[model samples]
Target: MPNSSANQVSVIALTQIGAALARKIQGQLPISQLVLPEKYAVDGEQSFGRCQFKATCQMLFKTSDVVICIMATGIVVRTIAPIIKDKTVDPAVLVIDERANHVISLLSGHVGGANAWTNRIAKLVKADPVITTATDTEHVQALDTLAQRFDGWYPDFKYATKLINGRLAAGDRVNIYIDSDFRGIVTDLTGFTEINEVADDRFDVPLVIISDKTGYPKRQNSIQVIPRVNVLGVGCRKGIPYDAMQAAFVAFCQQHGLTWRSFYQVGSITKKQHENAIHYLAATLNIPVKFYSADNLQTVADHYSQSAFVKKTVGVGNVANTAAELASGSRTFTDRFATDEVTLAASRKKLKVDDS
Candidate 1:
């Protein structure tokens, strides 16, 4: 089994069964259902309502990395399919038994770390792991052998598991840039895009998702590709004058045609703990941010796209660079700013993003 831990993950449950499971798995994992007061409920009724379902599911899907559909009379599945069918973040769909804690990895089990998760749940709840994915049953094979297929170029493809399979079928090459010997061919791993599977970084790759996963992709011949056309993020005091930050961010975005969502993470001056501006930006851009402390900024030395003036003055890359780097999962970006100084930077990762 793949050894991994739950870092930043989100969960969505369709029914009471799903909600119960979500609550049980809390702390050990991430969940989508948040306890809300009756007054805040959209249904204008008591605890749960149809409106609540719609609004809750919408919010849940937005932040979730996976969606777990609890089995019932199948109403739960029916109610939430349309909402999820069109979601941008392809959530790993799983079906769990309401009666027993048994977890069935119906869709995404490996690529989204559901396989490992399945076992964890089984042991915790003392239930069965009904993992039907072929890769899990068989140890040797490419991701294609077990990957669930879905439509590429669709917002739904963002579902990690479905997208992996779709990318493989679409002829996206898997450029494994690992150093030392690594087991399994490119085809053997679930959702690999490349057929060559050779241990060479020189192979062509469209999307480069850098991870700390060892021996997967070698560094020697790897090329750095910024995955976004524009990246803008800002950090300021609680009520600091928004002029500089807003101007910088807007100017940078206007200079490049990029959607607000492209801005990934926000690196702020540690002193301004939980500032209002960050919350406002999150609302405006509709993107989540992974806040970084000053020390964490050091690891991104290589990827920081710092300008001469920005670098000389702030002594770090701009916010856009940090956001882009963090969003793209690359270590080649970082930015810094003072409490009063709201900084922004931009990248061209959107140069050739597929519209299809």
Candidate 2:
């Protein structure tokens, strides 16, 4: 097993090349994601379910700090490009062509903290990690990296420093979730006071603080950091002719009988021109608009019921499902996000979210 570190990483891909590469990378690194085949996604193993690729990517993007692209063509590019097109949360994006000959560092190489990840993954694979991030290339101070140091890292939070210059500074009451067997989590620097048993949900803890103990459960709820269910995905035209995208999103949530407070973010395709709707929705709710590039979104893939209209409107099927999956880790069939209309899945089963 990989000895996990401060943060978690998830890989998204279905192709033989992608799956093989993901396994190779996970062996050396601790932070990782689930590697699923194209089947067992949408409609079971009956049809090749790349149909919902965009939704799948969105779900994975929500759960990941970085995304590694392994496909070279088709909905992969079309699904991933729109995510990073506008100013956004910028997950670490690295690409390895299907041929496995070269790796390309596309976006957020520094802040997404993929540089160190590359160094670790490159050694496992033959090809070098192609990093284009200026700060990584120049070896400058990264605010995100500085905050994640775990030792006296009291201050750290940002959106896109180079692009839109957005910031989400850290504050008090930051919940830090770790595994039950996490012996080294609680320390003098960490301020965690309790570790309660929650339902079989909750993996989307955005803000985290180090816990100050050592008797973490080997099979407890804290194993999966910020594990949660019911992540809401929002989308609209880039420059959606609206002043309150958050309000609209909230209305949608309310209309659907969703617990408004349960939602952690408002997300969409990364196009500023069409982002007014999503940004408005997020700003109105004072939540973050976690954006991902199309390529970044493709890795996890989606399992939505795709239609011709959906293809024309969303352009891909994998993102929403992908984001939901990421928002709740790889466990997509959580209470609120189940494929069926019924909302209860784990509570009745008495399962826990972080059970290892």
Candidate 3:
């Protein structure tokens, strides 16, 4: 296994047969932990007593990336119904019979990757994989899957996705617009027409637009996928407030015509490694951030605009632009914003679509 779930899994076994089956699965998937009642738990299993099963399941439902329950579909459904919020945020939920005859993708089929995990678990247990998602059943590449494949951010519009995917499954025309810079290598082109620009006259068909730019406004039946190709370099005064940093970044995005989802990573000099505000900002945006040593940032400092005060304080004249350039590993470019407490710069990772 490639550890897609960060090695966090919960296999709920309600009975002896389920426990045996869970053990079989756990043997192959070392990342998965067996969750069973205390009576059924043998050793090295998460044992819950009498009335604790439901609570345990609820807790694991929130924490685990995948929850595979060896129980009736109805039981799993009722147990998780209260906590199920949305497909985007929920964990992959799978249901299997005590005998492991069928592995069903019960919830979060596409975005949470339950469908894929269902197939994997079925293969491991030699069970039939039951996936009911239209895209999977109809043999059409899903819009969300397409976004995920290319590291693009799933658009916030779920209704648009439902309508577009419905049309795609029904063999209707769906236009896909890939911005020149945002179009990475897509392996499939079935059930879609590639268009340079969405025509103003076409309103009957659905449109799928992939880009980091904010040029395409949301239409009646359209989904916009933001490519996570932007790298952010940030610098801030000591103990800068999180709200101020966030406001500055939001302003930067507005000025650049980019969505917050366009950024995949954040970078700053190592001196600000303990900066709580920067870390909070990155966490709020659900983006990973890294810190580079001042020496590493210095190598690229001269390529960008410098500040004497910054050099005197941190031994580097330009933290934001230099950090962005270094993190992106590209030739110098110039896009920066300076605020009273924060300086921010953005660099786009070289687009594969731009390749000749």
Which candidate number has the best lDDT?
Answer: 3
lDDT of 2 by residue, 124-243 (tens): 677776765554454443334433442221221232232111111222222344334333433332223234443323444322322222233333212222212245554343454554
lDDT of each: 0.44, 0.45, 0.83
TM-score, cand. 3 vs. native: 0.76
What TM-score do all the candidates reach, one by one?
Answer: 0.39, 0.36, 0.76
What is the clash tally of candidate 1? 27
**Pairwise lDDT winner, candidates 1 and 3:** 3
Best by TM-score: 3
User: Could you tell which candidate, 1 or 2, scores higher by lDDT?
Assistant: 2
Rank order by TM-score, top first? Answer: 3, 1, 2
Cα lDDT for residue 74, candidate 2: 51
